[model samples]
Target chain A: MVEFKEVEGYDSLKSELKSLEKSDKPVFVLFTGSKDSSGKSWCPDCVTADPVVHASVKEKLSEGVFITCQVGPRDFWKNQSNPFRTDSKLKITAVPTLIHWGQSNRLVEEQLFKRDMVDMLFED
Target chain B: MRATLMTAMIRTGAKQCCPYAACSSSRSVAYYSKSAIDTNSNYDLVVIGGGSGGLACSKEAADQGARVAVLDWVAPTPHGQSWGLGGTCVNVGCIPKKLMHQAALVGNHLADAAAYGWQLPKDHHVPHDWNTLKNAVQDTIKASNWVYRVQLNSKKVDYFNALGSFLDSNTIKVTDKKSEKTITAKYVVLSTGLRPTYPNIPGAELGLTSDDLFSLKKSPGRTLVVGGSYVGLECAGFLKGLGLPVDLMIRSIPLRGFDQQCANLITDHMSGEGMNILWRCSPLEVVEAGNDQKKVTWLSDDGKKESQVYDTVLWAIGRQPRLQPLNLQAANVQLNQKNGKVIVDDEERSSNPSVFAIGDIAQGRPELTPVAISTGQLLARRLFAKSSRLMNYDMIPTTVFTPLEYGCVGLSEEAALKKFGEDECEVYHAFYGPYEYTIPHRSSEQCYTKIIALRDDPKTVIGIHFVGPNAGEVTQGFAAAMTCNITIDQLQSTVAIHPTSAEEIIKLRITKRSGLDPRAVGCCG
Candidate 1:
């Protein structure tokens, strides 16, 4: 089983990113809705994409680092000026955004559900 | 001296270390450094209220590298109903209202669809299911609440589900059912927003406000809406559209701040849609009248007394700012005596230099969601990004979600005439039918559009008003044009898209001053 590291919120993501930058391994950052006390994401899309992305990350990208960055709840994601949406390094427009760090390719929203796309994202 | 101490403490990454922690003699220093060294005061910015403005401001501030925390709590309504995060817009105000309005619109479209040659079974009787709509709306709100929580967490903005009150200029005391804690920040924003106010009449508790009406489980059968404000009109309009018998009681005129002519047209459209409007009447009392019904007694302008029984009585009188609970005196934030709203400067800074107010809580600003969001974002940018741009309160476009929607931007006709003399201004208007309405043979009597502009050379457009289908969609582009200083000639010179209600704006030639019949003659090339 592929072990995926999870970090809560933007500050933790920033700290995790800083640590990841020091490593030579390929970085895969998946921006998702933060899980509630019920252990479920508010984003239905993220809920659907989470397991598929996790399984793919574990199988194909064994050597790569998988960082699941929980973007805060619904209202925060809906905000137009959110760092997840506006940040140059990670311009996340939708939930369940999978990005191969420093790469041009990214899968957003429903694309995260496709195992082929998840594999393609991991391959790069 | 205190500033230097704070700077040194922040620079040295000192936590839980205060020189004044043991010193009880110097009260000011102890108080200041106590907050500075405390874990709660670690935040660079603390925003109160998780409404549109507060949430936006908090996220933006956090994005700009400010350690931020947001505190939000929903006080139960008089009817003992409360909602989750995302404030009034998401929970009770804009989102649910718009959805219910859309549901009512779909109801009308179904009737229109039948008229459009769509055959239905003879037994097909489509009735409005209140529970289904109520559940759907609540579901959406719940989803939004979850999203807000996730977003706040993801952005690194600490979310405190507690009611916040000022303990000092830089420190706030947050209390929930579980416990109480003190949070301190370098800067604090007050965006607590507002709540609907009820009349002080006898047995008024029997009535419901917009806050409770949206989440009510049962159908609001045979409703009576009081007040002439947009809230009352919209609730009455949607209720009537849902095929319920609705009566609206207004003390005087309708739409107090909008153009009277447009307001009259809106009321006329509502009347045409079977809304019984009682003008110049005030509610005297509401009493329970057996079997889930309430008897509403009212007095007319001429002292005529009347009573009616209704399943629901919605009070849409007006909204009051949520400042009382914040204990403004504790923070020394000045409020406008007349309106009880926080007084703010151009930068939305309150009387206390470190405190700022935005959205509906700030006096003399429009109480719209977009306005609040924009102001919040701009305020954050100015604070953390070192940008000096201020929020522009002028020419903000707003749409009333009446059955025949009304949308307007810039100055109203009365406002324009009052500002600049009648001779300096000219008004162009037209009554046109939507193509879809023609197919259904729906009366287009209330469908109209008007543009108010200066009579001088180039004739700069001052106000744009439209009363028809999709008024919001039609007025939004015109609002953008008005921002560019668009003139009557510029508006007319632009080629229009054929067979659309919005295109009627570009073809407005009959000036209201000319006394020419503004009615459309025919569909001509």
Candidate 2:
């Protein structure tokens, strides 16, 4: 079964990634917007891609670690100096970015909404 | 049955009543009939101009299962400067301007770091590198262009890197260097935005606009910025911040359409920062001098004519909608002749029922990136998803990234007084020092905040204005509060966060009408 983990903000995301670096299992990262007061992501694309990504992971390859990283509120994400954008290893430009950690495989924006693309990225 | 009737009407070239009563032209009927006949049309929506508004609308429409196509083309400036996708905000206006403004602030911080006890070499001269800063800003813009392209592709929105013009009511012709193609769509959105205009005078073409400033190959030295608009002040401010000599000439008022009190404070701050300001001066002519320099002559308010030579002359007079080449008339779209912008109703719909407008191209709306993005998204949802949410144009927040940033939302004090009448308006203001400014002995006299409220009991807040560091960040939350009709009592009752500039809003206790000094009295409130 796939093990899911959730973290908030850039500091927590960095720490989570660091802990997973030494793991033997393949790591998959989904960077999204933090929930607002209503418990829904302010980013529309993240709202659209969440259910699909979550359900697909449970149905498909279930051996790896699936991590969801909330990148904070709109103001924090809009700031160009946010480490998620400036960091060389991450360089995330938009929200709802899915990555097969340490691999060239990644999907951004509406690409995360594509079932076939999401399934392909999760393949062992 | 309707499809059959539409096909018959098209084949017979007969006039048919359109489903939308707003569409009066026979061309509209023909276009609607054609779409009905060909269910597999080229696209359901065609958005011309891939700027902030157009891109957002196109992507949202596609997400709602509409086949959308976006056409974008950047015309080179007179100085032969052009850029990739993402339009003015990314390439020239907002993104690069803010980055350079941040660079200027960092330069000031470095200078002030010495007062804060950061050890430095005695004669260390840290010269600003124009090329380095320009390259970094351009690199980010290029990355944004790639991301926008990727986003369109992933959303299944067709992207065309060509200039598009209306061929007919339903058809559009797009042309690039390599090829030309015509596309048909059921709906069209015009978000072509705006381009800077130069003053009509001798050798005016020799000067550059904001379009060329961000991507200029060399540093703009000894610059002469003509006009009193926000763009002019911002350019002059940043150039001065980077240790360059700048001369700013204003025709009349500085920052027209804004609160005069606040505008004067901004100019005062700019003058104190060592920028040369010539009020009531209008440019008469620009003559080409040797070595790529230009000689600018202007007429002072007293009718005295003066001439000076400078390495660069930038014109920030104004911008007009990019509607000349779009052939809007052919599509039956109405234009506001006074401003050259498309006349859009509250629904963002133009004269033609199937045609809509947004962004700078749309009349009577703030020319802001966030405003455009929100309007475009709301428009798409209404069109495709059957949502009836109309975009609220009121209480929209905007930031002017000057030497000391200025942010405001809702009405200005002057506007509020005029709207609510002088007897029914109350203005509360304060000037406080930021915590960081005290250590460096920086003067906080120019850091000002004001709230305009109704004079009645409870005093419902109508507007908020802020001028200081990170003014945009400070004003944003207040804008939301204004939308909620926050009252002075509610604002004052809110708990304050210590040691931050934003907390000053809640701590306001003095009214401007009291004729008392609004300056801070003690460090702790």
Candidate 3:
């Protein structure tokens, strides 16, 4: 069985990850920029990568918990000391970063737009 | 007296020079002519230092199927601090220093956050925690040490955690804590690097060197950094950035051999950032004060005596090659009388054809890690893989990670003017503000860049210097361009990455010879 979780910010993502830490199934996480009231993300690359990543995750992940994370607003992200960038475990340099949680498998920035790389991240 | 001291230093393997040019004593020559011992050759190569140079040479030779053994040992500093196998750079020098610099940069960003429209609670200020920052830096260093160890093991290179002293040109005496062994190689390499030197003053042992600062158990309170070497300035810069009261004392000009104009700008920016710089000063003595403090007494150039108590005093006077224990005399290796480092030919070959020296221990070579690594690999390739490419010592890029980082390649402005006369050289310069600094209204008075070239048609770039954020990153591509013999016309013709500090180099037009101001113009200029 597969489960899906949507996380809003870094704090809630930490709590959500804590609950999934002991799950037997694998975990996949996709981090993107937060959307506005019009549902348009401030990051152009994330807006372009969202549907492609979500579709690839649904098609390739047969039995893992897929996590869709909204990192923060543009202002928060621009602050060089933001938590997402500073956290040693998740030193995310840019949004639209997809990770095969707990593994070194990751696709960052434009890598998320490549269908083969996205499928490989989910399948591998 | 100075000549006597120089002769004694040469005999003892210290790099201190004789004040006079009268250092050609017969006694020094007699010291290194020890008779050779008979031994059977056991390996193709034996490297005596496990630093960047030695490790790279050993690994490259091993990859070429040469039987190699690396002997490395870290002697404790005066303060009893010792580290693992990756040498001064990974343990005490670059890695830890850059990480700490980053920590200070983070503090600056946090201070600028409010101007970027980020809200903070009233009266909410977080003090920098030295312990946390130290732990993070140390962790990275530890991991690198382990990785280097694993890499050596996987490469099939014999690793000996012991001190190697030369018995002859081909034989080495290796000694560990509990065992002693003898090994011989067809060729020998000396890359022992250097150690920080303390001034020849009374009670000098009380001060800490860079080797001991990285692993200090507690925070360094109000600090006094002695000397104006790049090491001294960098230590003072980072300490001040971390919100500590730091005083930098210099006996002469800061960064003696670098571009003096750029060096002055660095000092000026640091002064504006609240670092107290005491110029034309030299320390005479250091004595312990009560309650974990030391008082430094000094005489200024203006004939005044001054004393101040500091919780930490760092001695970054200079460095000496770690050759004392190696017993190079037994191998008949020659040392330059002027500077006590090993005398090597253009090919890095020492006085003895079978022996070589690289990195800091080699005379007249740039004491940089990348230079060491590249030369080591090239030497290994020539010796083991039959490659003929020589390591080019020209136009090598380097960065000093200060509060306002400085990165430069090729000759300095002074060197360019000296090499090519003032009438034959041209200098293009600019002082510009970074786009990111606008929100915080940060001062960009010291964010500067310079390009030096010949005044002839299609002037060949002789040098590039930049002092701004991410100076190293900005100067790297330019360094590559220099290697290709890039010309000033090509630089001007290339389109630049918009709104970047780096693009300022490509867009440079105002020359120092021109009477026009070199300050920044508005956007789209």
Candidate 4:
């Protein structure tokens, strides 16, 4: 359910960018450590994100492109959309994130797991 | 000039005064009268209970140039236990319990270190060192006690490490717990705290109360915790975190009188942590399981039978004020028949107005450590330093440290509905996933926030309820808002610290209402 854009080596990120051109939507990518030191692999958080992401994609056809980017060895804050790039704004602390493209193509509405806002996405 | 200086100099109100003999007052004659003149062994103020309230009052009264003596049962370290000062909170209850609980959390965090690719060696486990931790906790108590002792010495106020009881309208009788010596006082402040009692269930003798668990030898095996309180659930969760199998049994929903939904969520989260929950069951009896084991039996609804076997059983049903030994009946002090807590008025004075009670002994709706500490400080200000302002015992916040955390301020939705007509109030709520839960590192639990408001002008935010990460810390600021008469707009203006649990108190805005609800959004996640 939880998805992030994979950025393996330089080629993998380029391929992800190339693949996004065919979609009539915007895809947001995120990277977070998935090791035990972070907490637990089957923690209530780790186990649930996948389903949350999967449900969102399946429930909304109009929803833009969503992808998963598992952490590869040697990841850092070098990514162009790194939250620290601006001015230490957004204060991106923890993950199980829900990042979305904003009104502008280059900007993103990257929120940590917002169950409240997620519920609002699907209304009666 | 006199009025202005007196008002200006009374900053922290006395807990820093010299005793009457040593403290010099510029206009001592103006305030003195035949009745107010001190005689041999007479003091302007005498506070009982060296716990929070008594200690604070003693300090303040000394600062106010009032002769004071603090009579407390500053008991010798119990056999197989430790003590220093800081009363029950520092010595026996809150501080030690929190440290043990936090230690358990460290182990829980270390367990999943592998998922983050940090190759921790096999011997990385931090097995709880009971003796070491107990010593550390005692050291803290000792340090705090020394601080109090030094404060008293500096002020030259009298301090008695003994028990105090009311002998008359203003005089008190004291008997040293260690020695048979007796002393008397002029005016008394009663702040003896509360102690837990066992149920009348058969075999209950085999069960352990909190006082005994801190000295537990072997880790609990198949532990059975009876009571649906934060205490029972929290201990159950902590032991579970320490690799013990636990069963939590309660008569009703855990944390009764709280927001019903939060109670449900907290229990669910505990259950998620692998605890077995047995609800609608009250202990009826206990029997020996084996030479080394114990069995607890309970009656479900309509007399159905259920029994559980365990190596350890803990009871967290309730606590009673430690009032009996004080010989209160001799003084005709009113006690709450329902729970045996001494009844006190707005001024913390009993029906016998000369006698005053605070802490757990004084009957109150919520019994929390922070409230007790603050109440103690306030009582000392009025009694010791001669401050006139009294504390209002309303809108206090409390948090239960169950595995799944939750707490609230002001009235709960159920209580609010009863106080105001249900139709005349509004409830705004938000149920969402926590950003923390989304991280690949935490548990898969979502958070819920609920707000209660009167359906009137300003839509005043009267009650706030939260069940999630740091619920206690989050609700503290919100509680201040309610105390300060903060309207919905002022609360809106209090800029929320982003990515923090506290921010949830303000982030909620115009939310979808059930009907004519006037309340704003509730930030819970």
Candidate 5:
């Protein structure tokens, strides 16, 4: 079974990742737009990819940590100097960007929407 | 300071007569001192050259539990260009060339998009910024270099960023910027590949070679590419495709060793695409003409001297093995005097039995990256893994990335006919167009494919040739089939997926012996 955690900001995401740094299990981090009052993300791609990422990760990861980072409202993310955008390690250029921590595997935008792409990412 | 501390610890540990069981750190120190005490530290295998072949060999040997060391260092070109670990193919050859070729193809597609009802701005020509493409290509190369290094480290293979020269048959003196050291090995493998050769002409240094072109910061404006080697043709093709005015000056023939027909067609296609082709012309000299341009002098076939002014001059005449630096005489390694490559036996063992050579540096071996890599791995296996398999150098498929690419395996039509005699060889060919070319109306005349086979029953295919879009992709499968000794009957039985450039290969039916037009008809037939 996979352990799922949701983080609201960049600092929380970093702390979550730091806690799992020593883990032998595979760690995957997903960055997406935060949900609003209606439970829909401001970023349309994140809204479309939300179910697919959770479903695929839950099914594929037998034992690992999958962190979903909901980077605050559009105004904060839209700023060029946002930590999510400026951080060297993260370098999140787009919403709904999935990264396999400590590895180079990454999927962004519509890539997360494809079942095969998600399957390959998780399977590998 | 760290070296002094380590030496002191070793002496203290020795004086105390501490057993390895006493401490883990001391145990590791004792193991390290055993090798350090012996100045001529030995390795199971030492591979010189860090290119595709050298790296592959070192990794394979290490995987087989042999202590392997690979020494790789790149000497900068005259233009002061140097690259990291991964050799020619990754840094300057295939990777960058293919990217630039694809970039040129994308440029062409942009122009063609309007024909497919694309709402592109009217009469707006898309300009290709050379630096943008160059930087992207360099970044990709750097990433590959890092990956290769990581792979070597993970495989437990020691990599030396140093130049290796032979002290003896099994001893090598490896030198780097900081220090020099001699390492002896049970076996030494020399895979130092070839470098671009410049013609012996006055002011030759004024021209750039393939080594310099990939990393060039500025756009190669109106250019004259001298020589008809695949390198010259490919550079000419891509430069012209990239919207540069490119002139190709051929001394005698284009693609001298490849199929003459395919070579002619490739040049013809480039010529049709607005590139100037100067046949039977040899360059005399290249001199600076001021304003960041050059005045190139050439002698024509008609005993006439001609001159042209161009912003860039590139020499793609040929490549020669870089053997002088290795000091073959010191190791008693013999070379083929005609060409500077090392003379090696079937097992790639040079005159010095303790030493072996592979890749382009070995005499009569195909100078291709894949060939070098395979040979390297095989040599390692034979040396360490108790494998007796010799690297097969037959039916190796290769692709020349001209605007109209040429990919083939086995004999050329001329070679097949000459070897099998006129009556024994049969050729089936076709001129076909890809469906995608329909709307864009790209010329289909040079888009061709051919099969050379025995004239007997079953007609076992001896050669496969393709000239079209995705030639490499189309020919790779056939290369495997050729390895299986697939015949015409087998090929004809296998159905092809329609609407692909590759399908044209399977649809080949018209024989040159039949004297009928080999032009393609509708897809249904």
Candidate 6:
């Protein structure tokens, strides 16, 4: 029998870039959902793109810092929202987005994908 | 530091790895790794849902020498995906529904048995022992299940009787709805098919869904069917044919977004079948009328509540994925929040990358059984590395099993009109009564073919919607054409077999209503 540690949940503040300041690790932040009025290309995981965003982060940077920001129906699950911001920083847009935040909680880089593009994204 | 990780990922995805475990993770890492790593359970492939896709996936894997297991929840024997192993299309959904409707259509022919100058035996009162007929249908399902079980046994595939859910990516939990067993595999193919949705409407539970109605006992004296789409029409129509007084209520317009013209014709024919149609009406509640009857209360367009006395209430609104108990999340598979469908890549991989899903669970564009079967086959071939490339999902066609029957390949007129514009779109329609019914002048013998082609680019037939006789069976070949991206000219140039509803496809011409070049559209000429 395997004894696994229960994954704990985070308290809600608001999911902003600044939330990464709390953790020492430089986290990979992913924002995902429907297309905005500005007409961004969309991938309809609808609201469920939250876990997907984190999964993609775990994909490329397995041990790298990882955090998630979601913009949709406000009744976000207990741990699914951000620790700093609630409403979106940018107007709501495409899904499964990977936003790389560097030290000091500043935005570093971000990207979206239609199919398998890990090679393209991470390749120097 | 980031640059190094990025370069590593790039090289990781592109560089060929050794045939050992780590490189095996790249080649078979997606779904197969889980299947491959599970040594406790001797089976490499164990499919839980015996619907069309499940059967195809398991049977093919077994053919490839993988120890396989297939489980289904269908009772009186699960014949659906078995195809004998063929799956639901042959056993329940398509085959039996079409056969039942065909039997009803023959009712019209029996009326004219004397016109052909044949000596009448007891005035052609066709014997329809409802109990006996129902049993006969169930018998076919049983025999098909037996055949499937026999085939799987011969092929050395374990056939379990249970509903299979995920214990983990590599482990499956099978509950016979009685006994439960947990088995693990290296890979899992989730193909548990869809079931009718029971939305939280008042008295919703009182009504029977299509599954219950199909295997029902005594026919209701009066049946109230709610839902405007094919399921509603089919259930009501079948009940009416079985001599049940049927009233069909549609809250919205009929057929929802089907070709407006075809929807209207279907409504007309449903009324002609002695089935009452309550347009712009919906069931609000259901109450009991003694033990054997039900009182269905419905509201009209004007918001007036009317009491309806029905012996049975069949709710045929829509179908949603039946994946909750399947425990996809345990396997790191994610389902679309807006719909119960799963998130899948073009190859049908879940976000986890260890599992693959198809059919209702795979959350692709189409949700028909045939679509599921196609995806299952494609996934098997791709995962096993048998195929050179992946499956194409464009232009998949499907049909409805209504009394008048409707089949559509590609886009509808409404979608076409929206995409291409009314001015740019054209429809070629042909009307005919099958020659077999024409001599006696059965005017309702109305069968029509509709070909939707872009006006400027008329050579490409974007959609083909056929209604009337043999719509389901005849549409298959045409659907195959559309799957291959067959143009209008290609469809027209094909030789047609005569005295058949399929011939109407080749007989498409400029509709009596509108524009075309001087040349007739049909190829036979």
TM-score of every model versus the real structure = 0.78, 0.80, 0.77, 0.69, 0.78, 0.70
Error of 2 at B477 (Å): 0.8
**lDDT accuracy of residue B288 in candidate 6:** 75
Give per-residue CA lDDT, model 5, range B190-223, as digits (tens).
9989889999988899899999999998999999
Worst lDDT 10-window in candidate 1 chain B: B13-22
What's the CA error at residue B89 for candidate 1, in Å?
Answer: 1.0
* Model 4 score (lDDT): 0.64
What value does DockQ give for candidate 2? 0.07
TM-score for the first chain in candidate 5 comes to 0.95
Candidates 2 and 5 compared: the better one by TM-score is 2
Looking at candidate 5, what is the lDDT of residue B188? 86
CA lDDT, every model vs. true structure: 0.86, 0.86, 0.86, 0.64, 0.85, 0.63
Q: How accurate is candidate 3 locally (lDDT)?
A: 0.86
- Model 2 gets an lDDT of 0.86
Deviation from native of the Cα of residue B497 in model 1, angstroms: 0.9
RMSD of 6: 25.4
What does candidate 1's lDDT look like per residue over B185-227, in tens digits?
8779999999999899999999999999988989999999998
**TM-score winner:** 2
TM-score quality measure for candidate 1: 0.78
Residue range A1-124, candidate 6, lDDT tens digits: 1111111122231333354467554445454432446644243453344344334444555344444444333233223344323434332233344443431112111323221232222220
Alpha-carbon interface RMSD for all candidates, in angstroms: 13.4, 5.9, 10.4, 26.1, 9.8, 25.9
Docking class of 2: incorrect
The docking quality of candidate 4, as DockQ, is 0.01
Instruction: Give lDDT tens digits, candidate 6, residues B1-525.
Output: 323422333343322222234444553464443333333655656777777788878877766556678877653322122223445565646656665666566665677667777677864566565676666566566556555654565566677767778877778888875699888774578777666676566777777776665456665557888888677787677667766678888877777767877787788888876778898886778877787687887778788988877788877788777677787778878888987787877767666554667787677557677777777776666544345356677677777778777888888888987998877777787766666555666554346778888767545788898887668788888888877767777777888788677887777766534654423233334
